[model samples]
Target: MSGTRATADLAARYRVAVEADDPRVLIPLYDPGALLDVHVPHWRFQVEGRRPIAEQVCVLPRPGRFTTFDGEATRDGLLVRFEWRQNGPTGDALVRQLHAWRLRDGRITEHLVFCAGVWDRELQQRMAVEAPLVRP
Candidate 1:
């Protein structure tokens, strides 16, 4: 497949993984040596290898609906911006994130995600104010 088509396939596969409620579906999307940079609120997990990454995703508590994913295929790779609202049995919350994935040989070689606290606090505060009003 062409690069654009491949990237689109990867994006579609990711959505399928979420919809299937099976993180194991993500396995084929990455290389054995793929690197994952996961940034969250209280901690950051910089993981390498398919098994470890798969394990982490498997253990993740089902965060609520991923409301939207807007993506573009770039010269370097693909950039996916996601808007999510988490409503588990325990709590409810919202988050906006950007993921940059570098693909090689049709698999994700490097994946970096920017989540809460990664950007300016003021910008986050502004987003917090505006996000609820804007429909996903």
Candidate 2:
């Protein structure tokens, strides 16, 4: 398959795994020594290796929440953006993020995530936060 097609397919599978809340499904998609860099409002860290990445995925919100996922293939990777909504202390909380993955030999080598802060119902609709990193 073409690189673009492969990247798109892999990205779609990644989205499916995330929506299903099953990190195990993404194991085969990553390189053994893959690196994941996560940057969110409250936390910033890096996880290396597929095992750690999977563990990180497991901690994310599972089913029962509302999510919208969109992905596209870049020259050497994939760019995916998603928004999630779930119950919160005051009302519904919303989270939005952009995930960029660099794939080699059909496996992801580097994954970077840029996230917006969790926002309450009203704030979520009114706030506009741009992603810190642009596609390179």
Candidate 3:
């Protein structure tokens, strides 16, 4: 269970977990001892173990809607990306991110994530208008 097929499977499970907002839905994909490394702006931190990692990673911290994109397999893992859309105290916002996952025996042993900071709806629209995506 490696390569593109495995990556696809991981995406399906991840998407299901996110949509269900259930950490339990994501636990099975993780090893008993798994690590979640997160990077945002100039800061970085980690969450350890399947339960804790699943708990933190399964859903957005605050109220929000999100869209999951397709994942691609790397030599030892897969890259999973998504967008978070939220309406906060200020207004509508967006955050984009991707996770680089390492799997073995069909279970995730670790994953690293880099986040694109949150942007208000206005900035999102401006970026959309000004920046033509070279690739989706």
Quote model 1's TM-score. 0.76
- List TM-score per model, in order: 0.76, 0.79, 0.81
How close is each model in CA RMSD to the real structure? 4.7, 5.0, 2.6
Kindly list the per-residue Cα lDDT of model 1 for residues 1-136, writing each as its tens digit: 8889889999989866765567788888889999989888888879898766656543333566677887899887899987666566655555678889998888888888877533334555687787755553
In candidate 3, what are the lDDT values of residues 1-136, reduced to their tens digit? 5367767987888877876688888888898888999998889999998888888775464567775566778888888888877766868877789889998888899889889888888888898899967885
Q: What tens digits encode model 2's per-residue C-alpha lDDT throughout 1-136?
A: 9887787788777777776777889899999999999998878999999978976755553333547777878887888888877664557777788889898899999999898866676775564444333641
- In model 1, the worst 10-residue window by lDDT is 116-125
User: How well does candidate 1 score on lDDT at residue 3?
Assistant: 86
Winner by TM-score: 3
Question: By descending lDDT, how would the candidates be arranged?
Answer: 3, 2, 1
